[model samples]
Target: MEIKDWITLVVPIIATFLTALIGFGVTLNKIKREFKYTIKSYLYQDIKKLYRDLYVCLEKVILDPMLAFEDRYIDELLNFKPDIYLFSSKNLIYCYRDFGTYLFNINEAFKHYKIEIDYEDYDYDDNGNVVGVNFGEDEVQEYQFKVSTYKEENCPSSKELKEKVENILDNLKKELNMV
Candidate 1:
């Protein structure tokens, strides 16, 4: 091809590459913002339910101490197995049959961001697929399970603490009634 023809063809190709790069940068920023907002909204809803349960638990404990797990806690917990997540991050939970019933807890798969994680940036798998999510702060959620298990020690005499946690958890369970 002549010099003018080569220049015409190559210049358009270069322009297209530059435009694509700009578009990708913009898309990245938008995704980050959207991910952050969605995480925050979900986290806020969870927190609200958690706090409400705490309030109820405090009321129950202050009013009555006879509300032990055996009375209604076990059955209630069995009915509503809750999946607890915290901050603006994606955390998974796993369970396996131990003896008879399944014991539930947080999934440590995302343990790299165990203490601290950023909700936006994450590492992708070799297949160019998103693999993990990270959050900024190393936030820890302390759930006060009302049931007095043989394992956990009581830091406070407040039976209400347990009830408070339970109430919040139950509410959360209902919220996630689907998945």
Candidate 2:
């Protein structure tokens, strides 16, 4: 074959391969972005649900006189409850934890309660027979809320807090026919 003909054939082949490669690269990048967004949104949803339930429970504590839960006790219990998780190619693990105000009086009035939920893990290095972990250590996020008492400074703003308290009282009064 003539050298010129060979060179022409090779150029088209190289061009075709490079084009294919470029297309593949773009596709891969798009896939990666979508994957990350999916994971972030999923994690957010799980955490949101967990927090919503937690808030419902916390509200009961703040408002209910015949309360199933106590703000102070919750504060004390905040040591560990509610957590999040993580999943990645390098790390196959899940984590979950959170903290918030537990007390609410009037002056710096509210004592915050921090809650953390840990996705238990196994401690292989530990000498003890303890195998798996149950929501081990909590990584605190927004811990200041639990430490502060002011409505605006903390959470469950003054209006929200007052509403909860009144709701609880109203329910109690109605139950007992107090008014």
Candidate 3:
């Protein structure tokens, strides 16, 4: 009815609306922060798993005495490429490139070695008496093989790549405030 009465009603309504709006904004912000943290955690875990897979493949290819070709290693490495490219940042992409280069160089070095097999002839007496064995030079044959006498000095060490991945994980943890 009067101005003072109208003012009183309008002030309480405005204050109530403002309080509700502020409360909703705070709740929304909290939800956003939680969502962001969850997403980051998932991403960090995925990246770590990818790095582990790559590391295992490289180690097997570089250290295994029986590994003939790098086909399996290359396949394992390439499996993570799309994920790295799509979900990772620039720094991670660079690290992946460095890892890929190391693998390529190791594979190339392994290609240079060849496998040679030698046959031996044994002499026997008429009474089945054992004599000596002869390994003539002519009995040896060399064939191109995928195996490598890979010395540790020939390729990048796993420690170096591991440190790089750990550094990336550390950075991610810092960014997410998980550390």
Candidate 4:
């Protein structure tokens, strides 16, 4: 072929190749951004829920230390520990560890110092007649002393748990660029 003819054929081929390459790159970048957004949304939701639950648990325990030994609290800790390790940043993981350790100590302290009281309820008939007395089925009251040497010695303050949870959430926000 003549030089002009060859040049004409090569130029179009090169232009088409460059166009396709640029288009592919743009599409790939968009996919990457979308994937990152989806992951971030999931992480944000899950971690927020986890932190909220943890905060509520801490508040309850601060009010009544015996609540630390509830089955729901135990299950939440067991289930979320692995998730925290897997999905949290290094700083977040460390904060969670501090928080979890404090709660564990509180649980242990309650195991030793919690007080339970069994009480009875009376079912009265009309005309002020005594009918029946029902014994403890779900009539048990549980509490912990406000001034306990064991709790003062063993468990960290509830204020500490609040701070740790705040730290973890702050780290998560920084990671996701929501700060």
Runs in model 2 lying further than 4 Å from the true structure? 1-3, 65-179
TM-scores for candidates 1 onward, in order:
0.36, 0.42, 0.56, 0.56
Task: Identify the runs in model 3 with alpha carbons over 4 angstroms from their true place.
Answer: 65-68, 88-92, 105-179
Ranking by lDDT: 4, 3, 2, 1
> Per-residue lDDT for 55-90 in model 4, tens only?
565566556554455556766665777876886688
For model 2, give the RMSD to the true fold.
20.0
How would you encode candidate 3's per-residue C-alpha lDDT over 1-179 as one tens digit per residue? 99999999999999999999999999999999999999988987877777556556545644552332465765677787897688667776777676666666656655543221211245667997758655455433212211222443364555665665565555445434568
- Candidates' lDDT values, in order? 0.44, 0.45, 0.61, 0.66
Model 4 CA lDDT for position 103? 69
Top-scoring candidate (lDDT): 4
Each candidate's number of clashing pairs is 9, 21, 0, 0
Q: Give stretches of model 1 more than 4 Å off.
A: 66-70, 73-179
